[model samples]
Target: MKTFEATARSKSKVDTYISNFMKLHPFAAFLTVFVGGPLFTLLAVAAAVYLIALPLGFIMGWF
Candidate 1:
């Protein structure tokens, strides 16, 4: 019984925190999906290009 009450209280607190966060920073959630998605993709592509080019540059004596 005590454990059940504690779990309920914890869940209520988490729900309140999520509600407050949504109200406070709605744009943050939007930017995270839209802007951050593309930014991380670009970074990943850039890293891949660098990794591929490193060996090629060494072989071509351009390093």
Candidate 2:
């Protein structure tokens, strides 16, 4: 029981530490998504371009 209580307290401390860290460094999370968002958008645009061009390319090549 004592060990369990100790472990729970440590867990809560870790949670509090992380919460404070994030609060102090909110841009850490924002930067992750900000950088990821552009890469994801680029991939989506590439996929869309490939999809759109595939048919056009096929028609142009046939002619």
Candidate 3:
């Protein structure tokens, strides 16, 4: 009986905490896509440029 009561109280506290967090920072959730999307695209472009340049650089070294 005591264990069940404690569990219920803990769950309620967690629920309240999550609700407060969401209310406080509603935009926090979308921040990942807003920030991460551009960062990932830049890394991809840098990798592509490196890959394309390696072969051309090697071929040019033969000349």
Candidate 4:
């Protein structure tokens, strides 16, 4: 119960912070969510795949 309350309190704080940020920087938030998110996700996924596969490829003699 204590943990649940703590989690909820922190979550609401974060939600409030984001709400205020979005209100202040609506265009920045829009660009970040719409344009930057997909690009950042793609980059992160590519990096993860590269990091995981590079060693595997060498061990499997596929490289």
Candidate 4, residue 21: lDDT: 96
Poorest lDDT segment (10 consecutive residues) of candidate 2:
28-37
- Ten-residue segment with the worst summed lDDT in candidate 3? 28-37
**Residue range 1-63, candidate 4, lDDT tens digits:** 999999999999999999999999999999989999999999999999999999999999998
| Model 4 RMSD in angstroms | 1.3
Clashing pairs in 3: none
lDDT score for candidate 4 against the true structure: 0.98
Candidate 3 global TM-score: 0.49
lDDT of 3: 0.84
TM per candidate: 0.58, 0.48, 0.49, 0.84
Winner on TM-score between 3 and 4 is 4
lDDT of each: 0.92, 0.87, 0.84, 0.98
TM-score of 1: 0.58
Q: Give the candidates in order of TM-score, highest first.
A: 4, 1, 3, 2
Clashes of each: 0, 0, 0, 0
lDDT of 3 by residue, 1-63 (tens): 999999999999999997888678878745645876788899999999989988898999942
Tens-digit lDDT string for candidate 1 (1-63): 999999999999999987788689999867876999899999999999999999999999997
Q: Residue 39 of model 1: what lDDT?
A: 100
Better of 2 and 4 by TM-score: 4
How many times do residue backbones clash in model 1?
A: 0
